[model samples]
Target: MQTQSSFKTTETGTLFLVPTPIGNLDDMTYRAIDTLKSVALIAAEDTRNTQKLLNHFEIETKQISFHEHNTQQRIETLIEKLEAGDDIAQVSDAGMPSISDPGHELVKACIEAGISVVPLPGANAGITALIASGITPQPFTFYGFLPRKGKELTEAVTTLAQKPEALIFYEAPHRLKKTLQALLSTFGVDRKVTLGRELTKKFEEFIRGDLEEVLAWATETELRGEFVMIVAGNPAPDATVSAVATESLSLPEQVEAQIQQGASPNVAIKTVAKANGLKKQVVYNAYHELTE
Candidate 1:
């Protein structure tokens, strides 16, 4: 258990979590700007991008690069500065820090070192899009971004498919069609979906409809901005039946059942692994041991 008094004066300085605007510079809060201006140093996901926001607010605080690539190399330095009583502010190019952005590691370091962390609430693309999405707002899961596409992507989507809560995902313009197609294929065409693009900007738009309808719309339209995909919760019975029907079978029996259903060993292993929420290698080893 840990307690934090953000304003308590101590030898170590505070780590202020500052949120920048997702779009529309007017969204910048007065407190966010003041904290940025008052901090001893600023850790930005992209200094070049953050510089523009700083310029607009007339905040001259110096910023250092602290992105995904350099997170490991930079966390220690940021922690050291905090320990030295130099209050620091961490910001991403847009939105709050550490929500599919860099800053989580630094924040973890600060906590371990007993440095104070003060978070200033501001813009967040997911929540911003959610309120206007016409989808069930509460009891939602914010899955920042999907994997580009591979085994990881498959595993991620498969895991989320079982969730009963509304799903929120961020996707790039280029991959919008493909992701929508994947969602349609996995969740079925009739599933409800809402896509928010160019959020908080001049051309902001939301496409709300069934998966197939939105997917068709995406295929025909020229996707031009960042997207927030809000998918309806799983309807139940389908996921439950598959899971329950397979639970009665032993691991090897489950593997053979899939194989009898025309699945190859690799495919069967992957399927059973995902169904049981076990690692693929674990299923593979057990299946091989039964065969051996």
Candidate 2:
């Protein structure tokens, strides 16, 4: 067991996980600014973007490029510096680091090395959107981003559909419509959803309604900026009934049953495969053999 005392004085340097503003600059907190100014170095996801932020705050602290592409290469170097007692702050392009961005690996290395990791929470797009979404707030699951591929997305949504808590997801504008369609198909038409766009910015807006209604609106609207989607959970009684009905079925039987309940063959196969921890092709072959 490892314990961390964030403020305790240690021979090794502390690793600060600082959250940058998601959109509006005014959202940046005082402690985040103070930490950025106080740290020995800043490990930034995008040096160029981070430089712009530094310029705005007049923070002249040096930055080292630490992003997904260079994470493995940089962790060792950062650890060495931390061991040498050089305090470092890590930041993403926007929002909290390691949410849908980088910084997780370095944090892990620091923890393993017994270096303190102090996180100063400033802004998070997911929580900001959730509180105002008019959805049930407690007992929520934050799924940063869903898979983009068709089969994988369907499988993911199918698994998430069984959860009895609000679900949060981050999506890019270009893929919003497709994701909403996938959610609509998996979670059903009447499931409640809220889409928050340009959060905390001057043009911030939210669209709240059932999945079917939001899907229609997304189809007609021109999507811009990143989005935070809050999806209401499945009804507990229905989810419980469905789980009970499927728990005893064989793989082929499960796929057939899903198909009988209005799911397409491909979706049924993927859902059954995911639920059983089996490959989709295996479920597909099994179901086909049963039919043959």
Candidate 3:
């Protein structure tokens, strides 16, 4: 076991956790491609899907299948590669691999094995949506996707309802309406929400409003493409001494009042943004459109 020979030739390969674009191919970072090219092997959630990306860049590096169904069995093979002096890379079908994806097990196994792991930052649709939603992102929690069952979904959403720093989640097109309903029920009928659909794509759209308004918008629109939802955090209950009491105003209405309180146009816009856990720019645009 601890032989000098074992330590010497052991490659101590680096594991590159690459982040791919959420929608647009142009959003893919150069570093990610470089890492993919240089890695000896890539553990991809889906090989065929990643092959398209590889073909686009002409990266011929071979990929090993390591999806949710096969992750347990593949971890051993992946670890062996790392120990044998071959650097490896991991990527999901889209976005970051470990954030609600199947690559988490590999990351944890690498950590326990004492292998060095490096993560390259790039596009994250969930984060992009949260920041652009004009919601207070700091101290916010990420719940990648909601459970499907009525009972389990309720429990999951309800657990994070008390957070004061907003909540972020991802949802598929078919499940968005149901998840929105769950969010409205858990956070209260009046909670503010920002919904980003088809982010980083031409069809991208952002909807900002209280629960009822946002839910209505979702119902009225054609639900297409991936969805990212940023919900307002629970604010401190009103104590009553000339406090802004952001919770007092409806989301759209509060975003309106920050301007009336002598805050600059931008400040007023961002005030409601932070209060409801969204991006300043998104709120600014909503204000502009609503007033127009």
The C-alpha local distance difference test score for the whole of candidate 3 amounts to 0.76
> What TM-score should be assigned to candidate 1?
0.83
lDDT of 2 by residue, 1-292 (tens): 9988789899999999999999999989999999999999999999999999999999999999999999999999999999999999999999999998998888888888889999888899999999999999889999989996665676678888889899999999999888887777557677899999999999999999998899899999999999999999887523422331355677778777666545678888777776566777888889888442
The sequence of per-residue lDDT tens digits that candidate 1 reaches over residues 160-182 is 77778889999998988877765
Considering summed lDDT, which 10 consecutive residues are worst modelled in model 2? 237-246
**How close is each model in CA RMSD to the real structure?**
6.0, 5.3, 13.0
Question: What are the per-residue Cα lDDT tens digits for candidate 3 across 1-292?
Answer: 2212322334588788998778899988888999899999999988999999999889999999989999889999999989877899999988998987888888889888877778888888878998888877887888888778654664565456667778888888887877776666446666789989989889899998887788787788778888888988878432111222245665556545544433456555544555466776767777677552
Error (Å) of candidate 3 at residue 160 is: 2.0
Winner of 1 and 2 under lDDT: 2
Winner on TM-score (1 vs 3): 1
Candidate scoring better on TM-score of 2 and 3: 2
TM-score of each: 0.83, 0.85, 0.76
lDDT of each: 0.83, 0.86, 0.76
